[model samples]
Target: MKYTVSIEIAMPREEVIQLLADPAHLPKWLRGLVLHEPLSGVHGQVGTKSRVVMQMGKQKIEGTETITRREPADLREIPKGSVVHFDREIVVEGMWSVVRDRLTEAGPDRTLWVSESEYRFSGLLMRLVGLLMPGSFRKQSQQHMQDFKAFAEHGKDVREGKG
Candidate 1:
């Protein structure tokens, strides 16, 4: 399945980018995420890798993510937009799964973050699992977007000692 979500933050693009780039702050705002490990490469740059673990009820899945794109922050220049896309292969027990996410940003003092995910079921049994779990998946994605907005915007305030 493919889905997209967008939110406008009341913070500068640089601040938004900084918040998104930090791995330490993820669990505070990223829903379902229990662990995030920076694998390699420089922060906020393309080719950076991270190991992500997310929990859903009693099930936990792990995946490796590589930053597919990055745009530098520019204050004087107009906000041209940026995106961080992840290609993920998740494993649970003996089943192999895959998903992808694309986060995009636009507007001054604002961001339009979009997450798109595609799932591949291992077999007929897994297909049944997907069918029964549609609501959970949608809820997880929606919560992620909401948490991201709250974190990015409020995080700026907290850093400025306003929160």
Candidate 2:
């Protein structure tokens, strides 16, 4: 399944991108995120790798993400300036899934974050499980987007002495 959502942040694109790129700040804003460990590379640059763990209800999902694309902030462009794209692979025992996030600046102090995912079931049982839990996937993705929006906008305000 594929789903996407975007929000306009009240802060500049650079600030938003910078905050999103930090691994430590993820759990603060990302709902259900319990752990984020950087495995390699710089904080926001390409080639960075991290292991992320998120919990929803009684279930916990673990994944590893690698920065595939990182664009520098361009103040002149304001909102449409920079973008950060990454690919994440989630392995749950026998089931494997892949998700990609393409986050870009949209307007002045606004951002557009899109997440696309393609999941492959390992066996008939896994396929059946996916069929039964379709809503789980969609809900998780949407919740993350909402959390990011709140975090970025609020974070911007806090940083600019607005809060």
Task: Give candidate 1's TM-score.
Answer: 0.69
**Runs in model 2 lying further than 4 Å from the true structure:** 43-45, 72-83, 155-163
Candidate 1 lDDT score relative to the true structure? 0.60
Q: What digit string (tens of lDDT, one per residue) describes model 1 on residues 1-163? A: 4444455666665576567667677766776777777688764456666777887769888876665544333323433454545445545543554445444455555665555565656677777877787676667767776677767766522123332
Model 2 over residues 1-163: C-alpha lDDT tens digits?
Answer: 5555445566666676667766667766677777777788765456777777877679897877665554433323433444566665666655777677766767666667777777777778878878899788777777667666766766522123332
The TM-score obtained by model 2 is: 0.73
Measured against the true structure, the TM-scores of the candidates, in listed sequence, are 0.69, 0.73
C-alpha RMSD in Å of predicted model 1 compared with the true structure: 4.9
Can you give the lDDT of residue 101 in candidate 2?
71
After TM-score superposition, the amount by which residue 74's alpha carbon in candidate 2 deviates from its true location, in angstroms, is 11
